[model samples]
Target: MRNFQKEALILSVRNTGENNRIVSYLTKDEGILTSVLYGGPKSKLRSLVSPFNSGTIYLYNDEAKHSSKITDFDVKKYHLSFRESLFKTWAATLAVEVVISTKCAGSPEECFVMLNGFLDGLDLLDENQGQTGLIRFLWRYIGLLGVQPDTTNCQRCHKPFYSGNFSQNTLQYKTGGVIYSHSENGFVCTDCYKASFDNPERLLFSEITSKSVVYLQATSMCEPSVSRNMKLSDDEIASLKGFLYSHIESSVGTKIKTLHSGIGIL
Candidate 1:
């Protein structure tokens, strides 16, 4: 009758029969953990096991049978604000799906810290601010998960993202901007793109605006614990939303159902 005590972030919950459920959690010690909670909707324990909630959890591990069951869950932060609005819920759900997809590839502790800041920022931010924060969070999470986009330089040419003679100024970018090449699986500089796609139909991709590239570079270096009030313009938001979501969708290899279905609110 082994037992385990851990601090966990509840990622998802699924009903099992009429009186039980299976809950998945992200813990500091274990990357992802699933345990059966023996209770139904009306049970107090069930209510505390909500997704995105984080806190100490007690599990009774059946070592002989190799399974675990939830005995207690002491919620520290419900992150109830995610449930307050559909916009927040979409971003939160997307984050959960991404985490589950990646299985928190890096160290469990680092992944936990990253997700903690993400939920905290979402809770404090309004819809618009949450959009920026969500972009930041997804980029950071993908980076940690080893699928981050390389917006800094061209894959073929091996030069810093440049246009005309402005290579000296890394801050300035012009031209038709960078292209997220599906075949190349990275950004291509103007020269490389034109040389490769001469009089061709680029059916797989469109240009990622210079501004979007800059945003990608900026957020890539920025820490995940950035302030919640971080803002972006409407244009920036739209471009980033498309670029980040598409990039994540491609990386995760699945349709981002939350974004696809929540198009109205999102």
Candidate 2:
């Protein structure tokens, strides 16, 4: 058996047989890990095993059963700020849920940094911001996963998109993702959108919203604190949220449960 200790953020915990519990952690060393905590519910470790808690945990691998055992843990931060408001709680939950749902292909350092940073940002965000931080986090996370849409060029024509005055309402979405226009029944350039089809009644997006997405794509590279300063209108926030969540759903191949719980009272 191999034993080690690492800093970890609790993703979830569930009661098991007797007083035991099953705990899932996003760790600094091992990434996403699940272990059986003996006498967890009745033990002193119970308080440290719940969602969004971060700390160092001691674990040992049971090579024969191919599992890990959680012997004890030391709590670093409970992130109690999330409980300060329903929006905070739900947004924090959404972050945790996304982390849980994501499948890691390499080192989880990036995922851990983003998730931990997002939780900290939520704890500090103003209540009036709605889910802006959460939305930005999703956009940044999508970019990290390499599934972000490219809005600078037409997917169909391969030319630099010229939005000009109608930047917001001009962008279109079809099978291939966001396009410069709704020409050729999908993502195409302005000429294509204008030239194809006799009827021009099928506009797929609005102005400010698509612009917000473009802004987010640009902001995704900034640190969370810097990105949080970018103010977005209500309509822009809505559009960005829908666009990001839809992309996340498609990439993760499953609906995020906490997201369906609604942003909660805000």
Candidate 3:
């Protein structure tokens, strides 16, 4: 009286009753799912249940039953280094948290594809790079969540932003979001920024350093290999990191534990 079949990405797992575990996964067709796995605690199966693994999972559900159970799973690829590097591991963990916490049940195919790409990106990291890879992963994850920051133009005046104009730049941490100057509502020209700041409530802008601007623009569009080739200045990296962290905190709406554990943030 039980039915079975599923291929899923293991998101998280925790030991439950003796030799049992509660496993969470996201399926290509069924979306996010939680299943109880009996005898998983001390068995070989436990190795397959770790985070960010892609596997074929065998599941069973009785026709008359309401809950499904995962009987077994075989890992297709175990991304070991992703689980090893402090930054890559935590970044992958954060990506998982975003997917599990924000994605709706039965999310679209795009979600799965994006998740796969994220894992692939993590696998490409090496020790020579700073947290750039992790930062890119987090940024793209934010895009997947549909809360990506507006990096295009002014939030209020709707003018295009150029790097040359602004002597000072600013961004609101809360709802108003990224702006070029204290005046312009969003990213704006220095002239427009000055004009807008003259009138309170027109726009609020934050001064972004030249190096910061270059790094942000470059990282967002550059290929992973290209990003690796590029070296960021200390001040530039710090500014970019602060910008990304602020956006993540504002958009994701939760503090990442991995970020706070001193395991990922570099």
lDDT of each: 0.79, 0.67, 0.63
The global Cα lDDT (0 to 1) of model 1 is 0.79
Cα shift from native, residue 253, model 1 (Å)? 2.5
Q: Name model 3 segments beyond 4 Å from true.
A: 104-106, 127-130, 156-159, 162-185, 189-207, 210-231, 263-266
Residues 204-235 of candidate 1 have per-residue lDDT tens digits of: 56576765776667677654333233345787
Tens-digit lDDT track for model 3 on 70-179?
77788886877865677667667777776776663135466777777778766766743536766666666666666654555555565534333222333222222234
Candidate 2's C-alpha lDDT?
0.67
lDDT of 2 by residue, 58-133 (tens): 9998799898988778887787777778888777777777777774425488888888878876777776664787
Descending-TM-score candidate ranking: 1, 2, 3
All candidates in order of lDDT, best leading? 1, 2, 3
Q: For every model in order, what is the number of clashing pairs? A: 0, 1, 10
Worst 10-residue lDDT window for candidate 1 reads: 162-171
Q: Which one is best on lDDT?
A: 1
